[model samples]
Target: MDTLTHTQFTEAGLADWRDLAQGIHARFATGDFATGLRFVTAVGQAAEEAGHHPDVTLTYPHVDIMLVSHDAGGLTPRDLDLAGQISDIARDSGVSAAVEALVEVELSLDTADGQTIGPFWAALLTGSTDSFADGQVRDSGGRVPLLWFQDTDAHETPRQRFHLDVWVPTELAEQRIAAGVAAGGTVVDDSAAPSFVVLADAEGNRACVCTTDR
Candidate 1:
């Protein structure tokens, strides 16, 4: 299966889901443990029937689901179909989809030598260096946020090296940015508006508000 582009996925009319990072994600408010369990059970059965499984996390108040085609390295038609089915299931179960609560976070490091440092970070974060690929460290179990390297020229010691890449729905990017700014963070850069906006805290540490709109 070929991977679906962000534009294609957005055009698919999956109102309950958002494409973030490498997958499509959705969160449903189950409101209780039993309801969440039942919802998860139904989702499991549906996934089994479709032969495509989504990573599901059930908490006391909500269930989070993420679907991606690992073989294709991104979203595929199977994901879209499963997402639609899952949405229907949520409706039938009387669970409300909390689209606004869905978000993905990634860690990024500015590095002059990712090839040399990737293995160390990968081993430390995931207990295996095998996750290191294309200047990024990915936890196959999804236990940790994706960590990618940003190539940069070597600089002096004591400079900031790590920052967060927060992925949110495109429509929420500006709102999130505004909230951050209102909370004392400053917009350091917006030259890449709609795709990413760099923001810095009062103390100068930087992070990015990112979206898949690009």
Candidate 2:
């Protein structure tokens, strides 16, 4: 399936946002045939122990799971915490991918103490005053944001947290690296072992330009 990343959460894949209020999903690909069935049963046992039964689908090659709080609209903490435990169980089973892609996270902020700074941020960003976990207000949309507030220690300049991971077809790595630097992102370093390149986004979050050969 074509995957979508909602700031690391794809509704179609594995997830971390699980609660009595929201559903979660997880997917696993096995490296060998025999391991697949065993992994499923192990997952089942784990799920039952936590009093949460995940919706499961499996083929000879891959396993996919969707979990949700049938009661809530999106996701909840219970789902994510259990997902972490399940991942640990599968690691020893030798699954093909370490874990499925994506985690859905919600960032929270408190602007009361720093009203001026907070209002400025609100003007600059899409944040709203809607309340959420732990007395923090959140962005109105279900956006995964790395939030910040007025703090004495915060860098005066906006930090670079945005980065990119680019995967080019094998032989063209260096060419693409040059093009990336020319365009905007800086090529930080090269790891030939995994055939990956780390590039910083305009904002400074590091991303990879990897060929996925490993």
Candidate 3:
């Protein structure tokens, strides 16, 4: 159950899904609560049959699903298979995939001593030290965004230390960046275009627009 690389996941051609930091995500528009429930039920049955389950959120208008092999720490062939099955179920149910609506957000903290601060943040956020490992904090319940520490040199106070990592589908990255710019955000860096772009708000707070294309 080795983790699949981003390139491998992309090559799978899962048109309904986007590979994000946490896993491969997808959204299907059901247009109503009953329809969404039916879709979720079918997806659940399919997941049970495959012995691999996805995180599913069914709402009045849509159903969001994320697939990941936690034991492998990322996507694997099981995820790809389940994703295809889920997409097939969606098509059979006449639910349209809304890939553009898929997004994943993560919190990043710049710190010189993650070893010291990681545990503290993990305890505060997830109430367990087990979530603090390798400079990353992850909630098994998926109740909060993933938080990772970025190693940086020791610096003075009164500087920005926290920023957001916003993950979007590859096809929507440029459009998202453009919309941010139109909303008065500045593109501080595009040296990693199609991978990530740094954007700053009017007050200079920064966030990144990320895609899996790279």
Candidate 4:
């Protein structure tokens, strides 16, 4: 299946879900464990019927859902269809989408040689090298943040080489960056602004606040 571009996915009208990072994320309020399980069951049946599955999490009062075509390396029409079905199930189950529950984390490692270090990070993080590809590594279980190498020339100066790339809903990027600043973090760079803003802590450790608002 071919991957759907961000614009195409947006045009499909998935108001109940948020496109973040590589997946479409949604959280439904289930009210209780049993209700959450029931909702999950319904979603499972829907996914089974569609021949596509979503990454689902049931936590007491909420069920977080993420849909992506891992094989396609991005979202596809199948994901959009399943998302619509899932939205219907949520409505029938009386669960509402929780936008605040959506966020995606990715790890960036500055390296001069991605091929040389990719395998080590892949094995260390995922217990296998099967997820290593295109200078990035992802766990088979999809539970951990992806690790991607950022190529840079070797330098003798000591500095932080690893940083977090946090992708959140576009509307929330500014609020998040403000919260980080309020928490004593400084804005390192905002040339990219809403798309991506680099922030640094007191110790100079950097993390980027990223959005898919492009």
Candidate 5:
């Protein structure tokens, strides 16, 4: 499956789901454990039928779902189709959609020599460098936040070289940014608002609030 661009996905209008950096996420309020299990069962059946499955997380009264095409490295039409089907299942089960409940966080390392540092991070994070060949480090088990290097020219001055890349639903970007500001965080840059906004805490360390709305 080929990767879908942000515009293509946004144009598709997946109202029932939210696109995050890691995947498409949606939460269904199942009301109880049994109800949630039933919903998961239905989702499993739908996934089996479609030959694709989502990563599901069950909390009491809530079932969170995430879908991404790992091979394609992003969202595809298959994800959209499955999201639609899952929406149908949610409707049939009398579940409510909770779009605000999902977010994805990734770690980013700024380095001029990722090829050299990549191995160390992969080994420290995942115990192997197999995921380091392409200058991005990921755990094969998907158990850790992805660490990708941001290319930067060597600087003479020392600065914070690590930060978080927080990915959230498009609709929630502003709200999240505002919340961060209210929490004593400052928006250092919104030149790329909605797509990405750089924020810094009171101490001046930077992180980004990101969305796929672009």
Candidate 6:
């Protein structure tokens, strides 16, 4: 590939905000050239199946590899999932190297309006009136950064950027969507497991609630 310039980097930045994620990298070495070629072939098969092609370079008995799921935008559960599988493949081939690559993403969105809006979610999730301090509520799980609710003057031509994908073993998609609707969120779409219902807050900002099991 050609060298990327600063201008090119700036112009090619992510429009969806998910492109800032990091990928995975693995290094492999073998005593013989044939073993290296075999390793490359095995990696190719895995990449094709996962739909994630890894970067690879080989010189006789040494190969360097890097992996990132560019389609997912940022490092996500999926990226790590693929990384682990790749590690297992390397181990099976008698090639050993530290898997030194992982994607880390940090985000902070402070919307003046979101602060006021958070009370609604706090109430919905907790099943009680919001007792948020200064209109801020927090939800935490794993390495996920804080999802904030800020307070803004006005939103023009509202649209949903982030949504939730709630999973349940059974197809309770409609019922769950109703619960959100009952809690003051508008159900924007319920068309199509791997399905989602787009939603909007009382102020018309968008989010989605979906379940893969459905």
Pick the lDDT winner: 1
Residue-pair clash count for candidate 2: 21
Scored by TM-score, the top model is: 1
- Runs in model 4 deviating more than 4 A are none
Judged by TM-score relative to the true structure, which candidate is superior, 2 or 3?
Answer: 3
lDDT of each: 0.94, 0.53, 0.93, 0.90, 0.89, 0.51
Q: What ranking emerges by TM-score with the best candidate at the front?
A: 1, 3, 4, 5, 2, 6
- Give one digit per residue, the lDDT tens place, for model 6 in 40-135: 888788878887776677668667665554455434444444556666677799877622221222232335466555676556545433444445
Candidate 6 regions with alpha-carbon error over 4 angstroms: 1-22, 98-214
lDDT of 1 by residue, 21-126 (tens): 7699999999999999999999999999999999999999999999999888889999999999999999999999998887899999999999999999999999
Whole-model lDDT for model 4 versus the true structure? Answer: 0.90
Give the better candidate number (4 or 5) by lDDT. 4
What TM-score would every model get versus the actual structure? 0.98, 0.37, 0.97, 0.95, 0.93, 0.35
lDDT of 3 at 182: 100
Candidate 2 residue-wise lDDT, 82-200, digit = tens: 67777777777766442324222323332334545555445455544432222323454534343443234434345543333443433446676677788898867775634577776
TM-score of structure candidate 6:
0.35
Q: Clashing residue pairs, candidate 4?
A: none
